[model samples]
Target: MTFETDHLGFLLNPLDWQPAWAEQSAEQLDIALEAQDLAIIESLRNFYFEFDLSPPMRPLVKHIKNNFGADIGNSIWLMQRYGESPARTLALLSGLPKPKNCL
Candidate 1:
């Protein structure tokens, strides 16, 4: 995807993202940048609508297990597909902190 900044005006495949910019450019990112994308913070909102609380890593597993009725998926899928750790995902969805371990 391509992004623009009045500062840079246009960014095509720029690297080295900073979290403070999530408010502007985050939703513009695809999966490659999704982990730190501002929108990552919103994913938890969808989860909470179903589960009714912020998710922990383990609870996320259970929620998937109970909801899917199988163990076919796990946390890795969330990370791969959603660019989120359970804690980061929860925080993102809950509008909390970015994961300390996020790169």
Candidate 2:
């Protein structure tokens, strides 16, 4: 499928995002792009569709701990841990940059 460019040279996907205001650190950073063994694009889209905002790593951690029975490692290395979470992964999928001050 070809991503036809708009008159302003931007892609118009259903995410309702804009290229000029793109919050992503890299254009090629898709959640499904990494960890080939684990692909969750469909899930990400579903979650995004349900919630207008992407869940940050903090809430994601709590959600994961309670729901998935797992913690995102210890809190001492929060930046490191949150950065590696699926929420961050989903953020990447949504063209959003890493949480401001994540590192």
Candidate 3:
């Protein structure tokens, strides 16, 4: 199916997404994403913009670490917060394409 591309060229479904969608998605997952989590998702969006692809786990962690610092970038921490598949959660909430190797 054809999908609209975000500025970064990632497929997006804007109709199902809004700024609040991040928090809402987290709620559905039975998790709570605080400001830090939102910041990480924003960072992921930015990463896609720069690199034109969603990040896999390692790169996602590294990007957040470099941009937002270790306090929010550790993969284990992210997995704990977002579940075992953080890249999928991040992309779902951010309205971006599923990251490579996410499945």
Candidate 3 local lDDT, 20-92, one digit each (tens): 6676656767877778777777877777777887788898888878988898789888787788988887887
Candidate 3 RMSD to the real structure: 5.3
Best by TM-score: 3
Q: Where is model 2 more than 4 Å wrong at Cα?
A: 1-41, 71-89, 94-103
Which of 2 and 3 is ahead in lDDT? 3
Q: Using TM-score as the measure, name the better of candidate 1 and candidate 2.
A: 2
Encode model 2's per-residue lDDT on 25-55: one tens digit a residue. 2244331233421223344345556765455
lDDT of 1 by residue, 1-103 (tens): 3233323222222232235434334343343344433344444445655555556667656656555545423777656655655554344433433434543
Q: Each candidate's lDDT (Cα)?
A: 0.46, 0.41, 0.74
Candidate 1, which segments miss by more than 4 Å at Cα?
1-29, 32-52, 90-103
lDDT of model 1 at residue 27?
Answer: 47
**By the TM-score metric, which is better: model 2 or model 3?**
3
Ranking by TM-score: 3, 2, 1
Judged by whole-model lDDT over C-alpha atoms, candidate 2 comes out at 0.41
Q: Return the candidate ranking by lDDT, descending.
A: 3, 1, 2
> Which pairs clash (backbone N, Cα, C closer than 3 Å) in model 1?
41-92, 44-93
